[model samples]
Target chain A: MSTKTETRKEEIIRIAAKLFKQKGYSAVTMRDLAKTMGIKAASLYNHIESKQAILQDVILTIAEEFTLGMASIQNQKASSTEQLKALIQLHVRIACHNPDGLAALNSDWMHLEDKLEYYLQLRNDYEANFRHIIERGIENKEIKNVDIEVILFSMLSTLRTLYLWIPKKDRLSEDELSASLTKILIEGINT
Target chain B: MSTKTETRKEEIIRIAAKLFKQKGYSAVTMRDLAKTMGIKAASLYNHIESKQAILQDVILTIAEEFTLGMASIQNQKASSTEQLKALIQLHVRIACHNPDGLAALNSDWMHLEDKLEYYLQLRNDYEANFRHIIERGIENKEIKNVDIEVILFSMLSTLRTLYLWIPKKDRLSEDELSASLTKILIEGINT
Candidate 1:
């Protein structure tokens, strides 16, 4: 979503996500958010209830998007390799558009307070779905005879850290990254 | 090195690394260290000069290990694939034996004050050497025709996060983990 089209609350959540990325969720305050926006704390409070509210919005929105993306891929009638590519694209899309939010999701998701369990549930379900796809692929001989957790861990680590790499690497466009990553990740680097 | 052979200062550094992983390097106090060690703060000081000393030992020790690992790999007359597998094994060995130290190396290396520049120089050289090896592989038509940075980033990401995953994954032995990771990371997951 672009800044011009965002609602007041959406604007606050977006900016707060950046702040949470810069200063951890626990360290950020209402005044900090307000100062970043060039507004008074009272005005900031008008749109968001508290720092916790913004964190939930910042993290949960992206988490739900990932969950929904997984579901959408399942709805497609595609092979396991195609599904995996789609999954990579989903991450690339989110990471490209919402890098700051991705940072907060990685760094400050622990500070979700009462919502931690639900966030973890979403994450667990997401990984479960990812694992099931890989498992099915292995059973069907689409994937190689490899350890499932190793495959999952290796892929997830790279995808999770894409936020860190995406900024410093300005030459590679999102599509280039998606293609190169898919090739390097899905197709072995072996000649 | 095992606990039996470690000196008192080495024990403090090892325990401090665990503390740094649990509570970040900046948050841990000398008092907390003494309490955890079941000794007085004055006694703790007899072994280490300050928190900075412990932090430096915890992080730089691992950093230097990685640098030295890379150097040892260069001394071998091996192909790029062999070198890469050795690198993966190197990460697995360090992670399995010193998981806490790896965490400190990953998370607390930024707080290394005067030594930070040297630390970064070591990391940059390590990565440059890694990149050069892959580049040589590509030029020799041994490695797949893939983007060097993408391959580098993907492999480094997984190898770097071994500390977080090692403790939870008790079923896989060190050699098994190293072999599976070597295969999955180098050969890709495709059938």
Candidate 2:
């Protein structure tokens, strides 16, 4: 695509992400997106084929980032604890950096039917990566013997909620929050 | 209220919940609600003062149910572990029976602003009840020494996702699923 075409596509996707995150998928109209983007309603058709496609692209971008974050950790030969810390840090960082895409991925895409089914599979696949780390930790007796699925679900859910709870200005510096969260995850608040 | 008035209010709340849950809050108009109820649009104003009042009443009902669920556990005399189990069970029950309310409480009401702040506070206070159970568990040595905040966040997040994960029909009965989830949460899958 030409530079102009690529930029327009990015702009559409960006605006769509913000709208979908803020207003929700079902409620946002294509005309609304066009109006927000300062383009004719018909002009949007030239760049993006459908609303679902826009949603798919926004969600796929987030899924890719999450998978990439996990893959980078897996590629390294870190111990289970180190891998888990890396996973949490990367997840929260992506969440804070891209709240719109993150929220769309985590909350809004369920409205997308078949497109969402594809996203769900990708999410499960990514989750399997985390489960693998937790399984390894359990095997090594490094972490507590929690049900892998429940613990994995709990950890992922908690991490996803940072999008809702962590205000942009008040978010603890990444390094400090990572150190604190990592310590809590690996060791219970016992002593 | 008279029996007729009570029935009318429930009917309105039910229709509103369906519309809000499926179509979203902003998209569902009073006309739509009236149409769904098989009544004239203006007729709704008699039963509920306004759309906002309907929203408030629906939210207040859900919040009340949440508090009642929390109280059911709070009223019990048991170990912190037992309280945690009750808390999980109540959460799962509410999520199953009240998926719309769960989503609204978790995601939808961000748009409702100060109007819904009262509802938000009720839910938060209910959550604090759950958090206190975890805190007591840590004090009593029932739970592992994990960061109480992270663990609390994790458990609540995991529970919230039940609205998404639980199927309408399955081999696992609600009781069985709730029991399994409670177990997985209290005892990590080590042994």
Candidate 3:
């Protein structure tokens, strides 16, 4: 694809993610996407195939970003604690940059028809990679000996929902968020 | 209402909450609720007013439970950490006992019609109560002097979504979950 066409596709994906966040995936139609873009429906088809295409593009793009982020973190030489902080920062940065896309990825991923299994695979692999990090931490005594599930669930729950919280808290500098979450999540709130 | 009628109404609400969790508030109907309960629509009405009533009942009951739980915790003479642990236990217990209703409240509370503002007030008041606890904790040096929103958001995000995680983790006993989460959520995860 030409650069201009690729940019238009990216723009369409961006706007569609916002709309999907507002009105859910099932409720949005091609006509709505066209209207939102101020283009004819035919032009939208020029850039994207269907609403499903946009859904896949929006969701898979973020999902792949996470996959790539995790791969990089895995290749790092940091301790598990520092690795976890890096993971937290990864989520915060993504959520800060593309909360609407993240929101769409969260709420509308289930609506993906063909790519559903692939999406779930990416999610499961991500979690397994995360779990391995925690396991390594436990073995090395970097993390406290606790039910790994409890720690995993608590951290994943908070991290997964960052999109919902970050928008409400834009005043928090990204550095502040990354640092504070590192302490609050890893260090326990107790002084 | 008579005792028998009240019991039946409770049954309807319970089933409806389960359905709402599976589907969603907008997709659920009185007809669907009746079908789930193995009763005709007309008979369902004898016990309840409308779909709005069921939603209000399910959500308010859980919301008010948190309100009451917070009130009871506030009445106690304990440290902020203890109070926060009590709050965590309160959420775990509620999520363990009524995961479905809690799920409905988390996701479908926005669909509430007549009671939306009241729900918001209850929610705001609840958050205010929580924030004050954190503020007190920070003042007394029981908690670290981090951004209150970061602590509050991290903790509340986990607590709010317990309903999603508990069912998958029914193997974790209620007492175990409460204690482990207190450690993981409050006590940082590091050694």
Candidate 4:
């Protein structure tokens, strides 16, 4: 594709993510997307294949980014605590940059037609790798002896929903947000 | 209403909550709901007024339960730690009893036409009451000196999403789940 074509495709995906985030994936049609972009549906087809294709691109791209981030964190020699903090920072940065895309990645991935299995594989792999790190932490006495699933679930649930909460705030920088989350999530709130 | 009429209404609302949990509120029609219950659409009207009314009933019923739970916790003369544990137990028990209803309360409340403002008011008040307890904990030095919002957000996010996770498990009793969550959430997982 030409540079102009690629740029338009990117813009279409961006706007589609926003629409999908608001009205959900099943409710937003190609015409709705085109209307939001101030273009005819035919013009939309010129840049994108279909609404499902746009969803596939939006969700898989973010999912792959997370997989790559996890791989990078896992290959490091840092302690589990450091790696977990890096993971929190990773989520904060991604959520800060593309809250809408993150929302789609979380909520609309189920709507990916042909790519659903690939998405679920990546999700399960990402989660397994996360659990491995928590297991290592427990073994090394760097974390508590709580049920690994419980700790993992608590942290993942918070991290997964950051897009809903973080975009509403303007006071905290990314670093401040990550630090506060790391402290509250990693360390107990007990005095 | 006669006992038989009341029982039929409850049965329709129960089945509607299940369908709403699966397909979401907008996608589930009154006809679809009646179909799920093995009845005609006309019979559905005898028990319920409209799809919106059923959604209003499902969501408001669960929302009011949470509100009442929070009120009871607030009235107790317990310490923050004790109050927080009671709050977790309350969520676990509620989610255990009505996972589909809780799911609707979380995801489908936005589709509410007439009761939107009232639902939001109840939600905002619940969160405010929760924050008040955390603020008091911080003031009394019973909890860590983290950002109140961060602590609140971390805990609330997990508690709110429990309906998605808890229903998949069959081994742990409500008391066990509540205790595990309290330990991980309140005490932090740091060894």
Best by lDDT: 3
Task: Give me the displacement of residue B181 in model 3, in angstroms.
Answer: 0.2
Model 4: residues with Cα > 4 Å off, grouped in runs: A1-6, A31-35, A38-47, B1-6, B39-41
lDDT of 3 at A30: 89
- The alpha-carbon lDDT assigned to residue B67 of candidate 4 equals 94
Question: RMSD, model 4, all Cα superposed?
Answer: 3.4
Cα lDDT tens digits, model 3, A1-191, are: 12555588888888888899999998899899899888999889887789998999989999999999999999999999989999999999898888989999999888999999999999999999999999999999999888898888899999999998888887889999999999999998988
- Between prediction 1 and prediction 3, the one with superior TM-score is 1
A172: Cα error in model 4, Å: 0.5
Measured on C-alpha atoms, candidate 1 has an lDDT of 0.90
| Residue range A122-173, candidate 2, lDDT tens digits | 7888888889998998899876664466567657766877776555435466
lDDT of 3 at A11: 86
Q: Which docking category, incorrect, acceptable, medium or high, applies to candidate 1? A: high
Return the TM-score for candidate 4, rounded to 2 decimals: 0.91
Estimate, for each residue in B1-191, the C-alpha lDDT of model 3 and write its tens digit.
Answer: 12555688798888899999999988898988888877899999899899999999999999999999999999999999999999999999999988999989988889899899999999999999999999999999999999999999999999998888888887889999999999998889999
Docking class of 4: medium
Give the CA lDDT, 0 to 100, for residue A129 in model 2: 86
Task: Per model, state how many residue pairs clash.
Answer: 0, 11, 3, 1
| Model 4 Cα lDDT, one tens digit per residue, A1-191 | 12555588899999999999998898999999999989999999888899999999998888999999999999999999999999999988888888999998888887888999999999999999999999999999999887788788889999999999986675888888898899888887778
| lDDT by residue for model 4 (B33-148), tens | 88887889999988778999999999999889989999999999999988998988888898888898999888788889989999999999999998999889989999988878
Query: Model 4: how far is A24 from its true place, Å?
Result: 2.7
Which scores greater on lDDT, model 1 or model 2?
Answer: 1
Best by DockQ: 3
